[model samples]
Target: MTNQIPAENTLSIEEVQAAFAKSYGGLVGQLTLQNLSLEKQVQSLQSRLSDVEEIAFGLKRDNANLIKSQVTLEAEIAALIKAGPTADQIAAQGKAVIDYEDTETIASFAAANYGKEKAAPVEAA
Candidate 1:
């Protein structure tokens, strides 16, 4: 008796290989798409990182300049304290010399223009 295999029950090797290849190709396509998406995300993050680094560098530079200015100002203040006040500065601190004529003119202008009755205050609600 000859042994016979049923066609419906038997799968061909070529058919199995083709099925496996098709499934593998589909998986590879999905993985490729995922990889592309991840790459884009990485690129975006890198771009953001670059921008933050630039901003941080600028802030550092600005802070350094401010520190230098502060040091210079402190040194100038120290020198000024060491040297004491100038003659003109000491003279300016002395009592003012009033000009009586100017004072009288200013007082007359005030009396003429601002001696009127004051405005009544408004009542708050």
Candidate 2:
């Protein structure tokens, strides 16, 4: 029954709904993309932290094991020296086994590698 086209500002009910839907869809898409990027970064950081923690624990355990073995070996070496041979003779035999360039200027490599942590003080003290 209308005789002329509607004005520019006038729109059908369906067109208004469609336009709103398009704008909402674009906003959702952009937010989703941003959230995905943040999620990836968070996952990467978590994985790196896990690896660092594993490495730290492994080093601590290995250092502890090395110190235990070194202590046992030192005890065995001390016992051997005390059995009969002079300390110098025992040390000379050790140098033959481990090729030390300087016999007198001995480096305590084990002591250097395994750093000591001070024990917690007793409450009474």
Candidate 3:
């Protein structure tokens, strides 16, 4: 059967309106995808910042502890000298204790800062 339809009857106004609505929906979907991707990136960055803050706080705590220990050590050394352990022996033993404490403090400071997860600067170098 061969039949021809007039252009006016080819598409109704209702059909045109429906087509436009579908196109608008597709556009909204694309925008929503972009919005979600941005949100994910923001969350990732926030997590990284939080990790850094935690490491900084831990380092501060380590420094506080080290200072307290150093003060106690000083007081103990003064008392030992007052007790008369002689000069040379007192000096040698005291120096050994101080050296050990210093090394431990340095190691703790480094660990607290980066948690063995990253490279750090050498203080003496």
Candidate 4:
């Protein structure tokens, strides 16, 4: 014969302790799962931060290079202003060679008359 315990029956102290222990175990398991999830999120954030740092470093380097190039260009411009018109500038102004010829020609001049107008040699002097 199965004897049914009444719903109002009181639990002993050991039974109550066992019930609390079981509930506590479940709570601990849930807390562990939450901790693991939070740790994963932290790791993801750290990885994204590293990537952003790398991009910032690259941008910094590029900015430095651009500044250096700009400085160099300014210096070159200053030097050009100090020096007389460069060949390109003179060409742009349409100045021509001494024996101006409207037509273009190519020729190699010989040095056969070199030093002819210099002072005569000791024997001739």
* Among all candidates shown, the one with the greatest lDDT: 3
Per-residue lDDT for 14-35 in model 1, tens only?
A: 9999999999999999999999
Superposed model 3: Cα runs more than 4 Å off: 1-16, 73-125
Off by over 4 Å in 1: 1-9, 85-125
lDDT of 2 at 96: 46
The whole-model C-alpha lDDT of candidate 4 against the native structure comes to 0.66
Lowest lDDT 10-mer window, candidate 2?
116-125
**Clash pairs of candidate 4?**
none
Reference-based TM-score of each model: 0.58, 0.43, 0.42, 0.56
Q: Give me the runs in candidate 2 sitting further than 4 Å from their true place.
A: 1-12, 69-125
Give the Cα lDDT of each candidate: 0.69, 0.70, 0.74, 0.66
Q: Relative to the unseen true structure, what is the C-alpha lDDT of residue 83 in candidate 4, on a scale of 0 to 100?
A: 64
Residue ranges of candidate 4 with Cα displaced over 4 Å:
1-9, 81-125
Per-residue alpha-carbon lDDT of candidate 4 for residues 8-116, written as tens digits (9 for 90 to 100): 7979889999999999989999999999999999999999999999999999999999999999999998998876465454453333323443222111111111243
Residue 119 of model 1 has an lDDT of 13
lDDT of 1 at 116: 23
Clashing pairs in 2: none
TM-score of 2: 0.43
Local accuracy of candidate 2 as per-residue lDDT tens digits, 52-71: 99999999999999999999
Better of 1 and 2 by TM-score: 1
